[model samples]
Target chain A: MKSFGSIRRNFAPWKDPAAKPYIEFRNVTKIFGDFTAVDNLSLNIYEREFFALLGASGCGKSTLLRMLAGFEEPTSGAILLDGQDLRGIPPYRRPVNMMFQSYALFPHMTVEANIAFGLKQDGMPKPDIEARVKEMLKLVRLEQFAKRKPHQLSGGQRQRVALARSVAKRPKVLLLDEPLGALDKKLREATQFELMDLQQDLGLTFVVVTHDQEEAMTMADRIAIMDKGQVMQVATPAEVYEAPSSRFVADFVGNVNMLEGEVASRDENRVVITGASGAQITVEHSGDVQPGTHVAFAIRPEKIKVSSKQPVGTGANAMQGEVWDLAYLGDMTVYHIKLDDGQVVKASSLNSARIHDDPLTWSDRAWISFTPDAGVVLTR
Target chain B: MQGKLSRFNIVSLVFGFAFLYLPIVLLVIYSFNASRLVTVWGGFSTRWYVSLFSNQQLIDAAWVTFRIAVISATVATVLGTMAALALTRYTRFRGRFLFSGMVFAPLVMPEVITGLSLLLLFVAIGLDRGMFTVTLAHVTFSMCFVAVVVQSRLLSFDRSLEEAAMDLGATPTRTFFHVTLPVIMPAIVSGWMLAFTLSLDDLVIASFTSGPGATTLPMRIYSQVRLGVTPEINAVCTLLIAFVTVGVLTAAIVNKRRDLQRQRDEHAALRG
Candidate 1:
């Protein structure tokens, strides 16, 4: 196994405490008057990782990104980049670039000139800046429009130019604030992959801050879910989705159906839950709890099995129900089944074809059950 | 139907122009009148224009005014552009609001009060009042308006472009020069033009601040008009009006080009 020290050496960007991590936020906090915009937070971003800080509005995700870019200094805590502390370093000094939500392309500059700005600032020879700017423009598929001003380009073209400009200097890190948030749904989707491709192509540490859960799930290798200036959970999308650390994580990440109940039985392999709503359900349980204690169980909508008529099975984990509602998505159909005790639980069934050989529509009495592994016990 | 309405719009526009520009026409017409009485026209003659060209004193004063206006306008533009960048780019900065109020104060101030206060300031500083003092005062006054003009341009500018430049490995100073300055160049030009006009037409502030032997063209004209209207003075006024017209036209052309560029950028922004 590679030690942490060896890993740092392997990734040269993390070599010094100056480069221990590509970027580090150590106990950082920012306050605006009486309101604390960012509370005590420490984060480490490794080299070449497409990390995302996902949260709802006013969640301080953008604030954290700004601190890294040196636009807004943290009131307390230290920001270190390439292992060096970013105390007195201004935005220009840091080897970091940012793509604003507005793109902020200079209107007066042609596509080539806008992309060449940072190179010029580096005092690179004129010929070299031109060559690099042209190369970057071609990377973003903007070579043909080099002579056109920002106003002359389309939004997507302008975005590419902005991208070209930032990447031209090859900063160590790229900070994107809702990169595709302004585009229409289709365009946004297309741009998302293009952005990912670009990030991978450059192999730069990219920190994307966004509120859209799907976008975070699709792009980031690691996701940090923030709420009220604190990170609730940080994990890969699969882990965060499969076993959320808390109820907030479960609800925020995806569609989850929850059941409140008490633990009637417990064992190493599985546990039986006697729901407060008068339904007995068994789930694969791995948590800290006592048998007499009250608890909640969570199941993904697509996890449960649905069948017409009562099953020829007798157990504490099965329930008789009637279909209350149905929702038809293009790929699957969701059935909202009301249990005998009046708890409406949702279950999704795939629709592979236009015709349904077995349809569970409204008012159809049915039996619903799931393998213990399908649902997990959530204590918080 | 759209064409006919557009034609009607054109006719009304002509009438509007006639009403607005007829006074200028009268000013030029009377400058050529043979009679001394401005309201009465005796005959068409070149006497006023001939006398105006022959006046050495008026020419010297005009040259002095031009020098002061050009230098002050250029100085004011540099300072104003810096102020505009500071104001628009940084949010929640210390002393920002105070700085903004100070920049805007001179615009609404009456010329008389400004003149008096400046004159007192000069006296307090133990500085002699003359072309130097007048140029200093004009730059001080012109800078505020220039800041305001440039600041508006900065407000409408896309700040992201500068960030992009920084990301590309340019220093903040480089990003500003390469990205920010080029973006707001039109506003800088327009601000310079505005300052130049204000300095060229100034009378009240220059009157209080100026010392002996450094009289500006406006000050000289004021003294000449006081002695009763002369064809020479009339000719000078007419020539000044022509210069102002040309300056305004040039400023408008530059402004229109900037406006078109801004609109194109906005449309592009909406799409990509």
Candidate 2:
């Protein structure tokens, strides 16, 4: 937790998008004895982007970050930062910094001293180091606790101090290792916004590693979902959640009601599939297959429309389901409906604009419907 | 952190304390007996205590033991700390397994075996059996104890503190002294204390390695006890126990105080 909390300010002296990528992992692989931590990973991160490496524990996201920070030497593959290969670079010598999940601030040093550490390492003048330390304290809003040791500070405060310390050095790329995993739920939510604001203001390239889907979805510009030492999907959070490229990404992101469907017809933009309930449904995505191909169509729970009775003139994509379970989440209600074919579909309806006569409830016969574009047909 | 206990536990705890301390209590009581023979106690007298203060040979042996303990303890602490750091901080190396085995070999091997081996080693190296050789042998095993104690402390430690210091601009060496060393100072001090105690209590190794003029207090006491159980030896044992008890109590008190402070901090963190 002490190794993360770094922000990389715009540092190349000149801004040129046509140039090379900020940080590149060119076919990197890490092996510890017989256990392989990371496979041949090749990834390119642009400048000023909030990229997330999303995965479960031991999926090589941490290993990749360690390689970038010069903690682990890649067994094969070259890691490059700012056009130079990080072949012999040690952690302390690297221009990149990491914020550990543990918020690894020095317990003996005050907040200011902790922040001033990297600056002093670079042999900056005392006055300049002081000024920068003050600025970092103000940025993290710990000006009052500048003299406070890490143990004297709260977890959230220590997190900010680590962040401040990391930013004080102002490296080219900042690596965050489960940055928000240590905070309480409420503080984590609030700090997510603060971090986004800080990142936007600094316009730094940030690579955050986390297992928390909510945190990654709320913050990252693009996320590379990893599984078993490989990247499963690399896309924006919206695209990843709304249109997962695979079954793994779909299940990993959020709750989705997957229906077993057979391809019945196809168009350039749309494919019609006959579901297990003998209902025709249309889904939109790239790639096309012939009729009778086994395809899986996924729809998020909130995208489904539920009503007590079927409308007279319905187009397509309609099924009758009996309410199996209801989870009222205050702001919205999630309904788990079991279709006639025994396929369970989940739907969520908001409590916004309060209406008393809603027909969706426990043990109620309901017609669940969705638009053609509501669900995405996962390829592979 | 709470030590959960019930009435039965308290009772058993009292019983356990009696079982452990009953022997020491009897020993202390017999140390005060003024009888010429150990089986009979004629009366309580201060002759043994007076004899201990006046015996120059015993005093010289005690001085030699003290010197050996101080030097060996200091050497063991420094070297043992480096060994601990090498084992814990660095990734596995080719010789790591061998080094670890050698360091901890003393704890499991027989004392007589260790004493005999060191005697052969010193003789082969053309080293005379004296305080120097005794210090070397004492340090070799005492360092093992120091390394284990220090290594446990390092295990419970958070390594990020060192990385943070290094990130702040300190070299790896500087970070060790300025940040890492200060944090682990309590463990290091305790390791040194443990090593010192081991060296001070050592008799077999010192006896095997001693030369013409370097008879340690333990060696002298062993010879005296073989001849007969003298109150003089009891007086010395009593003094050694007193010194050791005071030293151990001071260390435990200091550790407990730090533990309480750490608990308070954790409580405050939880509150926040």
Which candidate's DockQ is highest? 1
Instruction: Provide the clashing-pair count of each candidate structure.
Output: 15, 15
Model 2 ranges off by over 4 Å? A1-19, A144-147, A285-287, A312-316, B1-54, B88-91, B95-99, B160-171, B224-235, B269-272
Candidate 1 local lDDT, residue B118: 93
For residues B1-272, write the lDDT of model 2, one tens digit per residue. 25898888989999999999987876677678788676678789878888889999999999999999999999999999999988887756888888888989889888889899999999998998899999999998899899998999999899866765665557788888878898888788989888888888899888888898999999999998999988787888888889999988987898899789878876776675
For residue A139, give model 1's deviation from the true position in Å: 2.1
Residue A158 miss distance in model 1 (angstroms): 2.1
Please write out the lDDT profile of model 1 over residues B1-272, one tens digit for every residue: 75566877989999999999898888899899988788899999878888777789999899989999999999999998888878887767999999889988989999999999999999999999898999999998999999999989888776666665665666777677776787778789889989999999899999999999889999999998899877677789899999998888887897799789778767765664
Q: Which runs in model 1 stand beyond 4 Å of their true positions?
A: A1-23, A80-83, A125-127, A312-317, B1-22, B35-37, B82-100, B123-126, B157-159, B257-272
Fnat measured on candidate 1: 0.74
Compose the digit string of candidate 2's lDDT tens values, residues A1-380. Answer: 32112323333322356767878889888998898888888888877888899999989999999888877899999999878999987788888888988888877777888888788778899999999998998999988888767887788988898888887888877889899999999999999999899988887889999999999988887789998888888877777888788888898889988777899988887788897768887776558688888888888998898778884554447789899999988899888888888888889988886666765778989888887778788656
Each model's lDDT: 0.83, 0.84
TM-score for predicted model 2 compared with the true structure: 0.87
